[model samples]
Target: AGGRVLLVEDEMSILKFTARMFQKHGFQVHTTAMNGLEGLEMMNRNIYVAVFTDINMPVMDGFECVRRFRDWENESEERRSLRGGRQFVCAVTANAGPQGDRDRALRTGLMDAFVAKPAKIMDLVAMARRSAEDTLGHSNGN
Candidate 1:
């Protein structure tokens, strides 16, 4: 994944591991606290190709972060929405036990996908890479 990634996670251990993995795979990664407010500030300051955030967080949660991101995109005055900078925001969490959890996440209008934790799915990085590629293609008129 040569593209840049914005990672929002509350757990220090998980955040470190995930950031290391992305770095090892050639991704330019930026991380933020689990707080939604902080994450939103970061998003507003920088342009990233994808965003991987945990569903559960302190201060501000993943759902709210996604909502803010979506709302900003929708309300931006730019005529070409894609040029506004697209991100594939996904949930990396252990809370897939309930169907409503996933449903609510989808309804938030920010996430592009979900992945369960203890993170058995090692291929998630690959999926994220592909998602980045797809986002770029869509934005660039491929």
Candidate 2:
């Protein structure tokens, strides 16, 4: 088993596929939410190594979710105690319109990475592996 991961997506197929991919790769746990609000609740309750969130959701979008998560990380001491520090947050979106969108997401400083929609499963798997390794390295003060 590897690390815990959270997937927040409104599309059922995508959510299931992503979860399966992580599970097949031996992630210890894979939690999912259909909206940002639910994702935020899950984040508060459990510790995750990484979170893959869709930009467009019905109730509470990913941007708001990222904002809230960042706020919680900065303000909540108890939550920080649970997770040690901030977890990696990745944005998954179909809106690969202009480079500006990617730039905007990055400027938020909430999203660690961005994966455009129709992303290859292998790419996602590679990102997860890298995230886990990075998290482990940081935890060990590397």
Candidate 3:
């Protein structure tokens, strides 16, 4: 199994397309959310190979969500011990390009990667494949 992936996107079309692509690439379980708040809620329920989140959304934005997620992961001894590190969070959004988002995310240690919108969805699948392999190597599963 490819394990699970969490997709946090406000766009309905992008969300569905991304989910199908991940499934086609052999990911067994896919969890989806329309906004960062919903994304954070999913985080509490299951471990993911990777999280692909859009930068903009209602109620909560990706940056804040990732910040909170990192905080929660750090605070949760159980999670830290089980995973051995922070979960992979990748930004998948229209705003990811030409704005130094990648640099900012890296510098701030908020997100691990970024995929600008309208690019190859294959990049995300490939990343998930690598993440799943790496996660399985170190993790005991959730």
How well is each residue in 1-142 modelled by candidate 3, as lDDT tens digits? 6778999989888888888888887785454688999998888777898898888899998888889988999989888865557798898767654555666676797888888777487898888888887887786654
lDDT of 2 by residue, 8-91 (tens): 999998888878888998875455599999998887777777788888898899989889988988888866554346778888
TM-score of 2: 0.87
Overall lDDT per candidate, in order of appearance:
0.74, 0.81, 0.81
Q: Which stretches of candidate 2 lie over 4 Å from their true place?
A: 29-31, 78-84
**In terms of TM-score, which candidate is strongest?**
3
Model 3 scores a TM of: 0.90
Write down the TM-score of every candidate.
0.85, 0.87, 0.90
Give the Å shift of residue 137 in candidate 2.
2.5
Q: Candidate 3: how large is its RMSD? A: 2.4
- Backbone clashes for every candidate come to 1, 0, 0
Q: Note the residue pairs that clash in candidate 2.
A: none
> What are the per-residue Cα lDDT tens digits for candidate 1 across 2-94?
688778888888888888888888888786555777788787666666777888888888888878877886676562366435556777778
